[model samples]
Each structure stands twice: as C-alpha cells, then as structure tokens.
Target: MTKGIQNSETPLFLLSMMMENPEAAELCFPQLLNNSCRKPLPPQSDGMLVYIVLSFISLLTVTLNLLVIISISNFRQLHNPTNLLILSLAVSDFLVGLLLMPAEILHTEACWFFGDHMCALNYVVDFIITSSSVGNMVLISIDRYLAICDPLQYTNKVTLDRTKICVCLCWICSVLYNSLILNNFLRHPDEQNSCYGECVVILNNITGTVDFVFTFISPITVIIFLYARVFVVAVSQARTMRSHIATVALQRSVKVTAKKSEMKAARTLGVVVVVFLICICPYYSPTLVGQDIEDSSSSSPFVVWLLYFNSCLNPVIYAFFYPWFRKSIKLIVTLQILQPDSCNAGIM
Candidate 1:
C-alpha cells in the first residue's frame, strides 16, 4: 500500500517541477519550436549572484584597460618603442573587455540571438584579437632582449616608426591568419550548431593541432627563449654595476642610471609575460589532452573567462608596478589632460 502511494505522488512531483520551471519545457524559439534550441539548464547556484559577479568583471576589465590606453596615448613621454608595444597590448585587451567579455556573458544564455554569420565573425574576431595580443608580447620580449642584451644598437633597431609599422603588421597578419584557420567555418556558419538558436564552432583534430602549434607553441617558445637570454644579460649587468668602482664619476653616474632603467623595464615586462602564460595555459590544455575545441553549451565557463581575465589583470599589474602609470592615471582622472601642454608633462 505504501509503494502504491509513493508511485501515485510521483506524477504530482513532476508536475510541480515543470510548473516551477516553465522555461525548461519551452524551446528557445517558440514560433517554430520543433527544430529550435532548448533553453539553458538552470544554474547550480544563485543565478542572480552569477550575473552580478560577471557583470562586475566585465566592467572592471573595460575600465582598467582603457586607462592603459589613455595613459599611453595622451602622454608624449610614454611614446617609446616599448610603450608602443604595451599600447598595442592594451588595445587588444580593451577589445577583449569591450567585446569578448560581453559575448562570453551572452553564452550563458545558451541560445544565440544573432544569426549564423555573426557567430562566425565573433569567433574569428576572438582568435584575431588573442593572436595579436601574443604577437605584441613577443615584440615586447624582442624589444627588451635587444635593449638589455644588445643595448648599443637597441635604439637604432627599435625606433618609434618601426614599432608602429610592426604593430600594424601584427594586426593585419592576425586577421589573415585566423581567417585562414576559420575559412571553412565562415563558409558554413551553422554547420557545427546542434540546434536553430545555438551558435557553435568546431575545430577538428587537424585544425586544432595546427592552431595550437602556430598560435601557442611557436610563440611561447620564442618568448621563453628571448626572456631567458634577457634575464642572464640583465643579471650580469647588475653584478657589473655592483662590483666595478669607476674612476670617472660623471661617466659612471650616467652609465649606472641607464643600466638601472633598462633592467627595471626588463623586470616589469617579465612579470607581464609570466602572468600572461598563467592565464593562457589552461585554455589550450584541452588541446594537450586530445579534446576537440568547440564552443558549445557543454563548455566550461571557467576556461573562457580565465583567458579574458588576463586582460584585466595586465592593467592592474601596470598600475601596481609602474609609478608613471599611476601618475598618468591621476592626470587622466582629474581631467588635467584637458589643460594646455599636459601631453608634454614628464611621466618617467
């Protein structure tokens, strides 16, 4: 008799559950619901809390990267070759916050409102931005390596004009490279999408492997090698400065100042490189484990957001380490930039 009673209550329990979540039964598009995507599964935790936290992150990313851009662009003293590379990085990070972060938040919705073309474009843009960011980092590594290891010719090799050209080329090549990688997906925008309202792109084993090598492995190898060389050279220079007692006071004073400036910049950039690799490594871990790279409903939110959170952290690192960056922030916030000859103000 008890078994029979329990069985009878099962239907009521299911009905209550359905009633509580009417959305669960509805398709993403109700008008022609048969082939449409289903709604997202309910969050395991408080959904409102999730939204508030993610929104805050998105806003912070934009705010911090914007400061980096404004500071570099507005202050003439900040317009050196190394800072130009930093400015390029800031642009990419700013876009990540402005565009990719919002799109990632939208992914939580689990049904894309934009049509298929937009979906392909979004992924392509994502790839281009990230690739360009890595390129900028590599350029920065090269700049520092030359400055420290080959200081005599560093000025001649890395000029403001040449850095500008390299930045432009980096962006252009990134677009071309990613567009090539995503050529097929752009051609068939909805090929990987399982449902009408879904937006997904798949990178098969071969394409994924190729992208991993070119985008991740090659660039990282170059970055590590260059920074290592820079580290050794900088250490030697520091030791030389410590051991040597110069007979000429004026010449020694000038040499010490220049060496200290270069070494400091090298240390700061090394921190940036380390933080970048930490944030980026997990996103490519699936490639290592032989998992298909797909943007789908089943994808982990942690992976995507972790990659984007790097951008926000870069500016924070700048603010914390670079006194000039802090000083520039004061000028920008206080609107002293609007005053005459503010761009000529000393930053370094």
Candidate 2:
C-alpha cells in the first residue's frame, strides 16, 4: 500500500514541476525536445491585447501610406518635386507596414516558422527600407533648406527630373550598402542560432559600430545641421518680411507670398524630421551603451516597435499640416477618383 501511494505521488510531483517551469509547457519541436526552442506562451489575455493593438497599428499604417501614394500619384497638381520625395517615402513606409511590421510581430511573439533564407531576406529588406527612409529625410531637409535660403535658384535646382534621379540613387545605394553590411548574415542566416528551432543573426562589435556610425550618426548629423541652417534663415526671412510690411506694400506683397510659402514648407518638413528623429533615436540607444545593435528578432520589442511606429505617424503629420492631403483623402474615400480626368483635379 505504501509503495502504491509513492508511485501516485511521483506522477503528481512531475506534473507540478512541468506546471511550474514555463519552458516545459510546450516545445516548438517535440521530436527533438531538448534541442528545440520552447514555444513562447504569454498569458492569453495579455497576448490577445498585444495582438489587437499591434494588428491595428499595422493595418492603419498600410491604409494611411496607401492613401498618400494614391493621392500624389493620381493628381497632376501634386506631382511637384517635394511631393515626389513624399511618394518615395510612402512607398518605403507602405512596405514596412505590409512586410516588416508583421514579421516583427512574429519575431517578438512567436518562433521562426519561415526558413533561414527567409530570415536573411527579411533583415535585408528591413535594412534597405530603414536606410531609404533616412536618406529621404535628409533629401527633404536639403530641399527645404534650398527653398528657404536660396529661393531665387530653388526652382531650377530642385526640378522633378533631378528629384527623381536623386530618389533612384538613394534607393540603389541603400540596397548596396545594407547588403554589404549584412553580408555575413546573408551567407549564414542560422549561424547564430543556439538550437534547431531558432533563427538569429548576430553582429560583432566592429560591424555594430560601423552600422551605428554610418546609418545613425552620419545621417542624423547631416539632417540636424541642415535643419539648423534652415531655422536661422527662416527666422531671418520672417523678420525681413515683417519689416518690409511697413515700408513697401506692392513690392513686399509678392516677396511675402513667396517667403510665406517657403516658411510653411519648412515648418511642415521640420515636423517630419523631428518625428523621425524621435522614433529612430530609441532604436540606437542600446548600441550607444556598447550593446550590439541587434535587429527586431533579438532587440528590445519596445524600441523596434517605436521605430516602426514612425512610418504610421508620418502620414498623420502630412494630413494634419497639408490641406491638399485632407482634400485628396476625402476625394479618395468618396470614390471621386473614378471620375474622368481625376488626375487633373485641383487638390492644391
């Protein structure tokens, strides 16, 4: 009777151990239990809430960016050089929403179902999109600086053709640069994985340092410097316009109109730059403390999500500041775009 009681208690003890240790709950690969990664099993309620929130953000990002793309592409009046740059940005942001966000959500919450090649591809695409976004911000800053400080030459300098060329070059360079930076990972996607059911890519200190400097430090410095000059010139222009308002009526009217346009553009772009900086800085913070700059799969979910959230915020900023965007969105939602000659619609 005692032996029978001990046998029953042994099973109960094993069951209790399994319940207490989270890792024993579920294995991603039951066939090779010890070699496989444990499935991440967050609390049901918390998991549902996280999924709902992140899914909503992802859907919203895709929708908003798609609207921006359609708005600029459909309207002829919106086909200016600045709008073209915005269009490029929207494309990158759209990809982030469609591809990167979902991938990141999975990376944060689930095991890797996709193969090693896919993991490498995902990171490559991520890097390209990120670099392109930064490049576009730098371009927008330069465009604003020229428009404000060199108004007389702005028209000639920032033509649509030149803008198109610059956008193409920016994208091409991003692909090449990121490919070179992450070459090792591309060659061996599973090199850093500790188990059979895991996917990870590790960057050494040297690679991390190089990526930090080129992608973060250099681009941010350029953006800040250009915007600083733009701020000073914009202030000077505002003061000049106020002074001229008292002296010359007709002459100041034309100049004031032009300057105001430039100033307005500067203010709008300034908001975009500031928001971009805010989102991007937290992502680099880990690296600043001598930590290796890991990607979404291995990095802090909060920091990664914060950076991805910037893509969603950008279109919101445009809609708030640009009347044309509001009008375009209205037309789009109303299906007015199906009408004849909608491309010629006067949004501006």
Candidate 3:
C-alpha cells in the first residue's frame, strides 16, 4: 500500500482464480493481463536443485551466525573489544540470513507480491546490513593493525567500552547512509517497474558511482593498507623474538609468546579479510567496469548468493581457527551452557 500499488485491485480475486485455474497465474495480476508480469514457468529438476541448495544455505547461515552470537554474548571471557566487534557483525549477518536471503529467493524465482514501498524498504535493510558488514571488516582490520603494530598500547587504545561505542556508531551510520542512498527510490518506489508485480530499483550513474567509491573503494583501500603495515611489523617482531630467544631468559620468553599469539591472531584475521574481498569482488564487478548496479528484489542470483555465502563462511572460519569458538560450540551443543554460573566458566 505504501509503495507503488495505488491501483492494486482484488488481489484475493486473482489468488482465487489461480487456485481454481492454475493457468490464471500466467499473469501475476490477472486483471491487468496486458501490463502484469507473467509468472515464471514451473520449476524443472535443475531449478528444484538450485532451490534446495539456496534454501540449505539460508538455513546454515542463520544457524552458524546464531551460534556465533550466542557464543560471544553468553561467555564472559569472550567479552573483549575484538569479540564485541565480531558480535556486531554476527547480528548483522544473522539478519541477512533471517530476512534478506529468503527475500532474495522469493523474488527471484517468483513474482514480488509485496507492494513497491515494501520493496524499497527491503533494499534499504539490505544496504544497511551489507554496509555495516563492511564497516565491521574495516574495524577488525584496524583492531588487528593496532594489536600487531602497536601491541604495548593496544589494550588502552581499543578497550571494550570504546569498541561497543564504535559498533553502535557503525550500525547507526549504516542506517543513515543507506537511507540516504535509497531515498529517491523510497519516494517513488515503482519508478523502475516495467509492469505490475515487478519490484526493481534504478541507480543512476552518479549515485551508483558515489556508493561504489564510498562503500567499496575507500574502505578496501584502508583495510589493505592497514593490514599491509601489520604484516610488515609482525614479520619484524617475529625475527626479533627468534633472534633474542636464546639470549633472554624466562621473563622475555613470556613476552615473546604473547607477541606470537597476537601475530597469530593477525594472520587468522587477515585470512578472513582476504576471503571477504574475494566473495565480494564479483558483486562489484559491474561497477568496476563503470556500470551501475541496477538491482531488483531478486538481483543477480550468483553473485548475490556468493556474497550471502560469506556470512556462512565466517563462522566456519572461526570454528577452524579459533579454539575458543570450537570449545564454546561444544558447550552450547551439549547444553552445558544452561548450568549454573556457566558464564564464569573458563573458555580461554
């Protein structure tokens, strides 16, 4: 009602017709056959297979991100700045799985039954989730950079309270920024619809370019630059530790071990950043080639799904690389988390 369907009529009548005569679905809005979008053909075996795969991915995304949220939120020992940033990312990715993924599947394979205003709002939520995810990645990179490059001041510089504040700011900015990007579309939700039942948004060259640079290029450059510096400093510190190990006794050895752990964490998070870039690159290929990102309720299936797949992979990465994550998962899976004073249990 809010977005592009001022003249929508007898939606139930169309539904009843479709129920009575399956062919009635040939027109999504049968009353306006000349203008309504034609329904997609019945699914083939391959189409069914694709649906199965995408549905499974949606389920996995929700489950994995939920576990990550639970693990981070419930465990007192996991309440550090880095983990807090991760918790924020998990919340955004959880919404992606719970809302965006299903919407993608529904719109791509079938008609968009929701009105145009709903379509506009859906894309706004999608942008907020995606942009905040990128923000989280940048924050993670900065956190790693500070930890590895300036270890002595890292705890003071990146405190839990400050990180919580930054996470709140990141989400707030995402909501505001994406709202601006989609403002025109929200005002005229049906501007790009070629026919009834179509839900699409048009991004002109200028707006698309601005969005491309701000959301993609600038953040990526910062991440790569920071991680590069972190890598160089980590290498120097490793050499220093190895060279001084024989000369220094127990006290120095403890410091060296601590530095090594920080460097290891840097390397692990570096892998995550690399994976994110890889999954996301194809999504912006059009923009990289000077094309606008014209999207619909469904959008491009392959690249968009690949982007959503990144959410699923993040938890898997933690499962493999973070011992603490695995341990927490075991505790949760076995229902040990329900025990008295479980939050105080030693996880690290």
Candidate 4:
C-alpha cells in the first residue's frame, strides 16, 4: 500500500502473502537452496566478532542487574514504594538482556532456527519487557514528581497496594497491545520461505505507525515532559536553599546542615533522571524512526555497542547515583567479607 512497495521488482510481499494463507510461505521457501539465494551473507569473521562482544556485554549486564535486584529484594530496608518501582525496572531490563539478547545473537549467527512458535513467543516476551520498562520509567517519573511537588499527598496516595496494582496493570496493557500482532497478522504462515517460516506480521503502514507511536514516541514524550517538570522543581528548590543559606549565614549559632543534605538528594535524583534518559533514548529512538531506515543506515560498531551499553550502564548508574542503593551494595560486600570471620568465631 505504501509508495515503497508500489512497483518494486522484489516487493516485500511475504508479510501480505502470509496473512492470506496460514502455512503457505513455509511450505514453499527452501531451507537451504545453494547459489539460488538472492542476498549475500556477511563474512564469518565479522559476524563472529559481533556475536562474541554482544554476548559478553549482554551477559555481564544481566548478571549485574540480577545482583541489584536480588540485593534489593533480599533486604527489608530497600522495600520502599519508590525502590519497588526501581526493582521492577531492573527486573525488566535484566530479562531483556538475559533472555532476549542471547536469542537475538543466535538468530544472527544462522537463520531463525527457533521456528514459528518460538519466534512469536520471542516477540511477545520482548514486547512485554520493553513496554513494562517504559511504563515503569513513567511511573518512576510520576513518583519523583509527586515527591517533589506534593510530598504530603504523595505519602497518602502512593500506598504499597496501589503500586502493585499499577505494575500489574502496566503488564496487562502491554500484553494486550502486543497481542494484536499475533491475533491479526502473525497467524498466517508461509513455510515456503526459509526466513518467512517464523515471520511475525507487520501491520499496514497506518497501523504500524500507530503501534510505533504508542510504543516508542508517546512514552518518550511523557518521559521528557516529566523530566522537564522535575528539572524545574529541582531548580526552584536549589534557589530556595540558597536563599535559606544566605539567611542562616547571619545566625552564628544555627549551623544549618539540612541544606547540604537537600543538595545531595537533588544531585542524586538528577543523575538518575539524566542517566535513564541517556541509556534508553538510543535503544528506543532507532526503533521509532522505523526499522526500514535503520537497515539502510550505515552500520556503525559504535551504535551497535551503544545499544548493548544501555543494559551495562544500569548497575553502575545505581551504584553511583543512588545513595541508598550504594549503601546497600556496600553493606552486601561488607557482609560477604565479614561472614567468614563470623563463622570462624562461631567455630571457636
């Protein structure tokens, strides 16, 4: 329907053909037709290098996030409502790095070896996790916004039960939104084509645009808006703090330490927001401009590495930017070191 496929010689008709016949493409396309293949494959050396680096980064990121998640979940002190949202986001990112990236690396090695069921499931899982991450980010923004703008009301409104319900709803909505792919377009299978066998349906251009808009563009907009508001609030607080410091400077007896504590909190929160935007924007922005343009764009190793870098940065961000999280990590490390001594004393 779009101008791209208007009169093309090798039209991308596989998606359309699969919609009409459930098992047509798979039955027709040969699995290993030597020399008859239309496109040339990448060199083994370069592809292997990509696989190795991506695999390493992905594994490292997942392990670190898992540790963060475990640390928070295990410790009673880390169970605050705000921290709960952070834990949710970490879990989602970890799953993306752990379960999804390796499978993607494998798919790049050969073809889509997993088949239709696995492919569909893969898409579903990635969709859910990515969506939830975005949703959790938005929720976190709102959480911070409220804490800044309406601390009193926030304490009353943001209860543990409400937070749990909100997370569950976010997951449900994501699943429903992604299920449209399976329900409408992905059902038709073309076994004739080797790659098309596990093909997920691409909706028409209008619907596809809507999907991209909702999934990527809209969330980014919301996050940017929240970030803007948060920045304004932070700037206002800093000015107020400066005014108080000036006033308190005259009072020799009242050495106000609260100003320093407030400034530290603001700095930590600011870093968290900035890092979240930086890491996530690269991954989501490319997916938003549409995948067609992405394919044609000159492949850069830096961009590829940056995509994986998003996952790798979360643990470091938490360790550096969040006071409570840093404290938790230190406590964990200290506990590990001290456990041996405690056991030795017990034996003696």
Q: After TM-score superposition, what is the CA distance of residue 229 in candidate 3 from its true location, in Å? A: 0.8
Runs with alpha carbons beyond 4 Å of true place in candidate 1? 1-25, 42-45, 245-255
3 versus 4: better lDDT goes to: 3
Root-mean-square deviation per candidate: 8.2, 7.7, 2.9, 9.8
Query: Tens digits of per-residue lDDT for model 2 on 229-268?
Result: 9888777767876675464665455457657676787898
Local accuracy of candidate 1 as per-residue lDDT tens digits, 1-348: 000112344656655655776753666654333576787766666886887788898899899889999899989999899999999999999999899988888888557877887888889989999999899989999998888887667779989999999999999999999999999998898888777777788899999999999899999999999999988876776777889955377645545755878778888889999999998899889999998888755678888888899998999989888999999999999999999999999988
lDDT string for model 4 (127-182, tens) is: 67767877887888777766665544666888878888887888888888878744
TM-score of 3: 0.92
TM-scores, each model vs. reference:
0.89, 0.90, 0.92, 0.71
lDDT of 3 by residue, 287-337 (tens): 878877977754678898889888988888989899999999999999999
lDDT (C-alpha) at residue 134 in model 1: 92
Candidate 4 overall Cα lDDT vs. reference? Answer: 0.60
Q: Sort by TM-score, best first: what order?
A: 3, 2, 1, 4
- On a 0 to 100 scale, what is the lDDT of residue 183 in model 2? 95
